[model samples]
Target: MSKPSKSNLKYKICSLLSLFFMLFFLFPSFIHADTSLQGYKEVFQDSPIIPFLNKKESSKENNKEQYQRLEDVKVVPGGQSIGVQLETKGVLVVGHHQVKVSEGAKSPGEAAKINVGDTIVEINGQKINHMTDIKPIVDNSGKENKKLQIKLKRGDKMIETSLQPIFDKKEKAYKIGLYIRDTAAGIGTMTFYDPKSGRYGALGHVISDMDTKKPIDIKQGSIIHSSVTAIEKGDNGLPGEKQASFQTQEKRIGNITKNTDYGIFGILEKEVNHEKYEEAFPVALSHEVKEGPAKILTVVDGEKIEEFDIEIISSVPQKSASTKGMVIQITDPRLLELTGGIVQGMSGSPIIQNGKIIGAVTHVFVNDPTSGYGVHIEWMLEDAGIIKPESNQNAA
Candidate 1:
């Protein structure tokens, strides 16, 4: 072919450069869209995005089913006081101790890079469930003069390390210089239970380690029947508490399987009895809860669960799981006089509105004892895996 014109060659070069720049900028958006699609597949399986993108009719149908399912949920409101004992999945390192060795004061665990929040799951290839499990292995390793192998979990990562135990001359034992804990015990109100499935949710919040202030990784746990012994009435600037006790040998009421930011969840071993709340009530989604009069089921006297009036000062319609979904105030004269509003042990007391379960008492206002924060019951059920909203199919 004849030689091309210089202007035509320049036009071809300019066109190619323009296309390259366009794709470079658009590539990031394409990757972002693909990543979001994958996340939706994992988190929003029932709410199909592809159908909604292709057909407007499909989006309307999916939205209707979600609302219908929320209206159909039935839950047994729980107000009974319970004692919780949680065992960690592994031996949790709460603090580090200084060991008095022949050389001087030092912490072997610190030297091994074991932090305060690290959970020791395995030592020398043996699984560790309790503090006792670690003592034997440490003692033998020190006596035999062998380096101990430790496998621990820190956050979402598993870590392994080897360290020689320090022989504490003063204590006459092998010391890793770690203060570890295996179990945690506390009292809380039962929020709700599903009579059909025997599943229960409680605490309305996560159980954090006293020292580490991080959520404990649950291995297993149990809830026991407890009786209110006394009430430390609250006031401005000081939150009150409910003193309760349960026999150590008392039979467990439930088994805890998961601990999340929302609360603790488990399967109840037996049916809970509440004279006033014998019937199961429909649960309301966060959007359905309104700012108005409501009632709370809680134990203020002995073991008796009584209903007390409260007002939902404000309702927050959350689209995701959150701890505080509403602001509540005690309106009942009896409850206001008895506990001075919500107390520590009443963390999971069921809040009922319009004869339906709306949420649970979570945190008491330090400045205003009459008012505190509440979490929607819907989030609690979702965290417990009792109600799978994403798995609900559209009504045919």
Candidate 2:
């Protein structure tokens, strides 16, 4: 009955095109919002998505809360030389060996898909504690002509596999073609101990396997009192070390629970005493540490916690956890003369400034014997479970 006029037809067509474009652009925004909401639910509440959505706002709020909590944290700085003995959760596979049989050369460990960094915790149904523990099992499996069941830990996952042992005619023994170690022992200075919780931290770095250079998966460990016998004074291009002796089996002063990049954490079985420093001191956050005069508490001699002057050459006010939070230089004439600055065993020596424990010595500069790096006491405490940071207090 009615045909639209040309002008009206044009207007109607233009209106439809406008509506189409509007929905096309707006649809994506709606979908994106919904997808983000779903993702948020799938992630933990404390996930980084919240900050990504509003970094500036979230960061301000987080920093405020963190600084507030920092005011409430109190810890005692440690400066005692200690002996460390760590037993891995399982036998750590350090390297592989080639077994020579009548047929040819082969490695059973390699054939079983085992890697160097794997920790062998069990053989068959028996728990493996030492390298010796595997010998009998391997011999029996070889004699019985059965595949040996192996349980190992790779990262956070537990893996199981089976491998046939090869008989070595020369040695008259079965070989798994793997080099393993179950225990590690060393000496380090104690960084700090919490008088309240008995928790302590030391070695301001991970206890890594010397061969694989991987952090040890600790089953259990202990710390004992050690006495420094001598020091190989460091010089330019070479790092010095502290010669120490201790009775590892005599008595355990503490129990180790964790080995982290920041340090080793544990609970002290008894109150640790430092000869010159018996009283506990307050700890300072990374931000509170300043570039100026400071001191370090470390034992260079028999059972004595001596305070040596040092300079906080430069301080990094870490917004997050880091190993190198401060640059330190040895200023005490006695320390410099005795140890030629920070030595290997001097790591974890408590750095004190303004009567507060600010950080701990972590590393020595190879080219500069008198200078080294220090980690903030705050990060050490966090690693020790003495204080928990609320947000991105520091990044690795």
Query: Which candidate achieves the best TM-score against the true structure?
Result: 1
TM-score for each model: 0.80, 0.78
Q: How far in Å is the alpha carbon of 47 misplaced in model 2? A: 38
lDDT score of model 1?
Answer: 0.85
lDDT (Cα atoms) of all candidates against the true structure = 0.85, 0.83
Tens digit of per-residue lDDT, candidate 2, span 115-152: 99999989999998887889989989999999999999
Query: Candidate 1 residues 81-120, lDDT tens each?
Result: 9999999999999998899965679998999999998999
lDDT score, candidate 2, position 47: 48
Q: After superposition, how far is residue 105 of candidate 1 from its true place, in Å?
A: 0.9
TM-score, candidate number 2: 0.78
TM-score (C-alpha, index-matched) for candidate 1: 0.80
